[model samples]
Target: MLASLLAGLGLGFSLIIAIGAQNLFVLRQGVRREHLVAVVAVCATSDAVLILLGVSGIGVVLQAVPWLLVVVRWAGAAFLLGYAVLAARRALSPSGQTLSVGTAASPPIPDAGGTALRTRTTLATTVLTCLALTWLNPHVYLDTVFLLGSVASTHGDGRWAFAVGACLASLVWFTALGFGARYLGRWLDTPRAWRILDALIAVVMVAIAVSLVLPH
Candidate 1:
């Protein structure tokens, strides 16, 4: 039982620790300190839910209907491409406040006695984006649902123990990643740094989106 649990934890971390769309989004939100808690919660919870579904034999059901995955693939690609465009725009023209260590690049409002008004990404918008990043990616299903489930089945009666371990891994990873990036905000204080980050994000998004539609 202990071995199975450890195996699951190992596999879970291995799969999730890779640099992917979801991880990149989490890192960005963490650095910006924008709805960080909600974003982390959504990611962790979604992973848990998907892990549960996989353990419950939903993977088999999904495999039987391959068209479902195809639909998800196209939708995910479109969404990713859309986000890539937005990221590219940000990279090209960074207006308003950006991620900083202790200060934001807020613009002064003329009508408000020259007081700087810090604009932020709304909580609702952040949450929705987090959800889309989590659920829309077909790779998430392939990793968390099909791959994890297939591996967990090998543990026989100790599958639940493995699932528990995997769940814990997700929670721990997201919590650390979301909270830890705050320290790196200082590096992104300059517009050049911000542009570089956004450009990298756009490139990654486009690459992933292209890979999704390409023939395997």
Candidate 2:
């Protein structure tokens, strides 16, 4: 039981710790300190829910309906490509606040007047983006559902233990990533550093998009 649990934890961390769109977005939000809690909640909760569904044998049902994956593939690729273009623009643009960070990081609250309204709007947009990234990606289903589910099914009566371990792994990873990103804010204070980060994000997004459309 302990070995199964440890294996589950290790597998979960290995998958979640990879550099991906979801991680990139979460890191950016963490650095900006914008809706950090909401973003982390959405990511961690989504992973936990998916892991549960996988362990509960939903993976078999999904495999039987393979067409569902095709739809998700197209949608996810399009969304990723769009985000890549936006990131590239931010990297190239000279006079935008897209990637500008602060030397002293402090979470910005809704002030008075138009500023508060903008903040609310930005937060809403961020929340929506997080939802889309979590739900739309085909790789997420492939990893959390099909792959992890198959592995979990092998654990017999200890499947739930494995699932719990995976859930804990996701929670711990997101908590550390979302909270620890603030330390880099001081280094990213300059536009050059921000541009480099955005550029790297763009490259990753584009690579994922290509992989989604191309043959495996």
TM-score of each: 0.90, 0.88
Q: Write one digit per residue (lDDT tens) for candidate 1, span 1-216.
A: 999889989999999998888999999988877789899899999999999899989999999999998999999999999999988987887552342222344333222354443346668988998898889899999999999999999999999889989998998999999999999977976667878988999999999999999998
Q: What residue pairs are clashing in model 1?
A: none
Model 2 spans with C-alpha error above 4 angstroms: 96-121
Query: Please, what is the whole-model Cα lDDT of each candidate in the order they appear?
Result: 0.86, 0.83
Candidate 1 lands at a TM-score of: 0.90
Distance from true location, Cα of 115 in model 1, Å:
8.1
What lDDT would candidate 1 get against the real structure?
0.86
| TM-score top scorer | 1
Candidate 1 local Cα displacement, residue 103, angstroms: 18
